[model samples]
Target: MPGIHPTTYLFAARALRDFGDGFVAILLPVYLLLLGFSPLQVGIIATASLFGSALLTIAVGFLGARRNLRWLLLASASLMTATGVAMSLADDYWLLLVIAFAGTINPSAGSVSVFVPLEHAALTREVSHAERTRMFARYSLVGALASAGGALSAALPDFTTGIGLERLTSIKLMFVIYALVGIAGGLLYARIPKRGASHETSRTPALGPSRAIVLRLAALFSLDAFAGGFVVQSLLALWLFERFDLSLAQAGVFFFWSGVLSAFSFPVAAWLSRHIGLINTMVFTHIPSSVALMLAAFAPTLPLALALLLVRAALSQMDVPTRSSYVMAVVTEAERAAAASFTSVPRSLAAAASPALAGALFAASYRSWPLVICSALKIVYDVLLLMQFRHLKPPEED
Candidate 1:
């Protein structure tokens, strides 16, 4: 860690935020159930969070190039703080819905927030082009590990209830802790140099030369994200609960291991990208994982489904760090922030549209149709991505 760039601090803050999201992601659906909300309502709230993030991130993508990244990050963290506080204190359905829309309450295991592109830009600035992939791998590794810890933290209520605290009280306290983490994250972002905003200026084009490539990537990424939305970790946990009768603690354990499995793949992806190239690594690793997901849907027993899920975990996330690195490598420096935002915003929108559908699908059937649907769509995305981008290598690859 000694030679690590200052941008690693952003990764540290990301880990903190993700940890809070980890437990809360799983806890959300369960908490809603305890509050007498139907599955469809839970899906609506999740959709609201994604849709809100998409709009906010679109603004950041456009305006961020002309503004202080440090200030924007601080503001985003402040919103996280507000979100956590409001959700913990409010019980009215409409009020909770408003909070979900306005705040950064991720229902998924992944980190999708306005903070993402800003941090990507900052982290890219800190590293040489040669170091970008490795650095992103480490960034993803830290996030996955922290998220794993957070997943395990879903058991906090079990411990709290054992000590005589009310179940709802214990769950609410997790949100309070989320607020505290946001305060810490804001402080961390504050320490970032004022020069983080130095890239923003009057002369910068919003997207510069990479506009076309960014648009294409955004469209493709949206497809992948849309498939992802159908089986986001929150809804997946709910499925396991209803479909297999998994307890909260058991689901926590499952996700904790899944996160670890995914974490282990990041470095492997970085190494693999060095050999097979980013596009190849992305296309090849992704297909098998999607296949695993498809097979999981057909699994007749819980143990078989869990095994397939673990396999999918090991292969699924190899593309994440690689995809981020590839995008940064292809885009011009001036367009980095815009590219990150534009690409991610579509993903958010696509992902946002599906949870309600997934909820309805889950509500209407005992079959794991959502998983099947997720796999088929993801496979289609993989094939299309390979066909479209096979020749588009990053500069380092050339």
Candidate 2:
């Protein structure tokens, strides 16, 4: 905490926004169910939100490096906050869809993929390579903890409704609350002392290698992400609702613990990377998690499903920080943004597809098929990543 003074505040604010997302990411599907949407329609809603947000991420990654990222973040947060308010006011399906499309600030805004690269580039401006990985690792730590907190916050609407708020209204209010808080965080970021964008990254780095690598990696990442997409916070909640008849509170508890498990896994991943390297760590640990996810599909009870999900969470994100770190490491500093954008765009697209596809599967009377498909495809990824990039390491700086 001693060295983390200003960074802590920023992390707190950033995490605030993430918390809103973490909470809503799980709550959205449930909100739609109350609106009387079928599973397929719910999936479309998610697809529109994510895929739309993804295209914006690409634009942000490229142009964002040239702009005031802080200002971009502030504006994006304001828009995201407004999106919540708008969604809350929307009364019907068509209106909600309009709100969804309008909520696409991530195109020119700070996002998870853009955020990691920008932050890495920022931290590098002042920090040394010896500490670079640690900074990224700490970021993972903050995000995991924040996500856990958000998942915990979702319980607020479920547990404390004595004030006579309708369940639908309470969930909407949670989104509103999180959005307003995100705006506050954005404001604080806007106030952070000045620093220019990372000039080291190229303005127009060659796209050939980065593109090829990203395409292959995206193919693999898409399979894994897409499989899980159907089970994001919202979809997972719906899955629990239908499969186990869990109330929202119970579903929240399930996600909360999953976040807990993820928080505990970040350090383990860093350490694991030392012993097995990034590729192995990503695959070995993940395959088991994917298999566990498949097992959850057949879980006889909510507790068992939660247990499997907990296992999955521990492995799900282990690859993320390392993967981000490794990808940047292997590419040119000037090309890092392109690398990030290339890979992330696909992930966003893949994530977009999962919800809709999973929803359709669920609607078609096979709710568990996505889970099974997810594990099988993930196993394929494990094999491919190791085969393709296991030996590739970044060049040492002079």
RMSD to native, candidate 1: 1.6
Candidate 2 lDDT tens digits, 233-303: 66677777888888767666666777777767777887777666777777788888888998998988877
TM-score for candidate 1: 0.97
Q: Which candidate has the top score in TM-score? A: 1
TM-score list, all predictions = 0.97, 0.89
Worst 10 residues of 1 by lDDT: 194-203
* Clash count, predicted structure 2: 5
Model 1, 161-224: lDDT tens per residue?
A: 9889998888888889999989999988887777644544546787988889999999999999
How many clashes in each candidate?
0, 5
Query: Which lDDT values do the candidates have, in the order given?
Result: 0.90, 0.69
